[model samples]
Target: MSERVEWDDLPADLRSAVEARTGKVVAAEGIADGLNCSTALIIETAYNGPLFLKGVRRTDEPGMAALRCEERINATVGGIGGVSPAIRHRFDAGGWTALAFGCISGRHADLGPGSQDLAAVAATLRRTHDLPVPDFPLPQFADRLRTFLRPGEAQILQGSHLLHTDTNPHNIMIGDGGGEAYLVDWAMPAIGPAWVDPACTAVRLMECGQPPEDALAWLGQFASWRRARPSAIRAFVDATCRHWTATVGDKSAEPSNSRFRRLLECGRTETA
Candidate 1:
């Protein structure tokens, strides 16, 4: 069962509505604290199942807009096989938008570092990418990359694909049934050049336990599918590390700085 959280922490209207629907609020607890949103594990009787409540943090107007976009994208992904388990409701009150979704039981998978988990995630990701972009504004990688790159950061945009932006294991759950894996945390999805998402995963997995060589091999498979040139992949990986490292320095995120460093060093050379 998912751990519960305090009802007082959620938006008033959202808590009321959810309580009305579920009959009672079991528990709401933080699952992942991120820049965009704070995910929580919520359980109630009405649904008779676990639910994930994603509370969009106050990140100024731009941050709010991105959070809304992520909600729309997740809803779209549902039309495909499944993406983050369909969102149950979106609560917007007092300028706060909280997204509630079904929570599948199971801890996020740990495929022993660089295991075939990459292949499994990649396959599911491809399915999500294949899902047609209808009316919603698809995330643009080229624009963000160009804007966020440092002076010497490499410009790598060879093949484009829908990316989850944050595909780390914390955001992916693998079921005990078999190779079932579900991607969560869509707050940072972007339609960008290939290898970026996988690279992010590769780095994080390497931190988990996967060897550099094994992680590199997984990246190689991702590159081949996306038709990304090796140089481009290397460049993207480097930029990804730089971006993450900068975040690690933030005072608010100091607690996670060590994990970020480990993520940055996974299969990474001092200079890519």
Candidate 2:
């Protein structure tokens, strides 16, 4: 019988393949919670560079398909110059496929209006939104909104666009690529009208201790950049905030599925 393998327990074959393709040994140090998967920081010397290795369980969750889809999306967007570069590594072992990506440098900070960092993120978001969705049957925004609302959130998100389901502070990597910041993590990307992304960001800012006024102003900047309707934006923003307040339990605690819960709720709202 074949031995069961966990993601953290790197297979020698996978490690060898990575070194053969990238021409370097990956001494991967584990990083904290990458949603349902595991992420490791692969360090290589001689300018071979570091990579973030993400793996998913093919059996336990159906959402693993989304992760695979994300790998496809990243591969397509890699040539576009600003997206995360996910290099697929061949793995003959336990269904644990991996992608070697360039480590995005710089810090992931709390977003604020007029902050060069936040502006860069907003700009990058616009760039992504402009990309052709290409017959992508994304989940409906209104339905998701309804699913997420507490009691009155539905009335607010009557119409909205797709959202970057996980826009929390840690995911927004601020890099000096071409003197700009870049957005990462497309695993749980949500399909909403538009405000969904900013609203998520606003809730993250609030969780990070920013005042409601400040979070709103920051979200306004995101709205202006994305050219989304104010009503829709406010609705999603309120939903995200309410969801955060409920699911987060402690304001300072890191939110686990607040993003997913928000997306599901909003989608439910749209379908209703």
Candidate 3:
């Protein structure tokens, strides 16, 4: 679970810096989602209206790096249209580094099987794959999960596609009226095979109630998925399961882990 930050608790300098950029913050509401961000808020400003703010202490290197990377990606990934919110400003103030984005008035997507949001999610993933790979160093999926993969498995995960590795339903925002799905929380973005992200989403779909075959079937519509070798797909499943196993420790007690296990079992059964 994530924690919330109160307006009064924010450092005076940080608040003043943000206010200088967007005008006085009339209201600040904590957004109680996303695990990595230390402080996530939806603020209503006197002049800017509503804007989303995410900040982290400079002492937290990983968190700071994620925010910086997000700012960089948002700056470079052109033609994304409304698939993601634009960064309004990024600044360092007080003891923290913060980013402000055009606020998205949306709700978390319902990724359960048969949900109408699935189409929007699929479209977003396809658009993401279509995005031109940025000319900067990004963590390669193969290198990130190498320890959990077999000898040749990591190679299969390498590509130039920009990947949003964490696809938890909460990170997908369904537009309030347009019904479009915007992918948020670019903290774990990477460069990998086009199939990799949709494959990850397949596991998430399984977590939402779709059986392994059905989940995989849904992703099969993507050219990348259709072209992926069976061996590579199996490798990805095994590595993802191992990754989550290390993350949650005991699968039986953790709901996320349990769902990952189900996805692993499905892959194992199909591969066997």
Candidate 4:
């Protein structure tokens, strides 16, 4: 996420490799956002095109694996309904793995109450939820959340539905006219209940200053979320609270802790 590598940092051969596809790399700018990719960039080519690029050092197995998974998923769905950016090129050479994705022109989603972006975000997520799980191995949400989940709760969330686990506003792009919302960065896709994505988005909405009741009302549009077991929803809340509270240090926790307080109340309401 932080800026760890710049355009000039890539080896000459790797640069040339990218140039070959881009028709000469005329400009390169680093995009400092998420943490999974070692290098994130926006580059312009002599071909007069700008493309998004993400790369990982060859020696970083986990990083490379994440990118490869993204590449594969894009290969299958990136072209379908503009759900994600299409991969223009991908290659492994010069001790590096690079993927060039069609750069999207848009702004991050605004999850505030009554924001027009909400409808489009909701539609886009519905499309994402409907995508047929491509024939490939994906990690299970239950397994990922297992450590924090208490007895009986793990089983409650287990499902075959595909999930975009990371739906932070930064990752959701609202197109020029705000008619389209694209979910970018497929670094960590998981399989679980259909309600999982909706639940995650609800948290983001609240994080963006929307009240929990309004957030839940907005999310109620999703049938899966509406039909979800109250107990299951509570489990998701408890597990995520435990996970986030445990991971973030004290200084950063207070503000974040405040946000989840209302969400925790919403969770506990399920039990009451």
TM-score of each: 0.74, 0.70, 0.89, 0.90
Query: Which ranges of candidate 3 are over 4 A from the true structure?
Result: 1-3, 77-82, 250-272
Where does candidate 1 stray beyond 4 Å?
Answer: 1-5, 57-63, 93-95, 114-119, 147-159, 223-226, 241-272
Q: Per TM-score, what order, best first?
A: 4, 3, 1, 2
RMSD of 3: 3.1
lDDT of 3 by residue, 1-272 (tens): 44556666888999999999889999999988887767898999988899899998889888888888888888554224646888887868889888888887888888786788888899999998888777788889888889899898888777888898888898898989788888888878889889888877877898888877778677778888777666666677677668777876755436664554543432333333
What's the best-to-worst order under lDDT? 4, 3, 1, 2
- lDDT agreement of model 3 with the native: 0.79
Task: In angstroms, give how far residue 73 of model 3 lies from its true place.
Answer: 1.1
User: Per-residue alpha-carbon lDDT of model 2 for 1-272, expressed as tens digits?
Assistant: 11333433676666666666666654556666345454345446233566666655455364467566666666544544644554545343445566667666666754653455666666766666555552465555556656556666555554334355677666777765553656666766555555566666666666666666666566666543245544454556555555556666646333533432332222223222
Question: Residue 9: error of model 4 in Å?
Answer: 2.6
Error of 4 at 57 (Å): 0.5
Which of the two candidates, 2 or 3, achieves a greater TM-score against the reference?
A: 3
Weakest 10 consecutive residues of candidate 1 by summed lDDT: 255-264
Model 3 TM-score, 2 decimals:
0.89
lDDT, residue 257, candidate 3 = 48
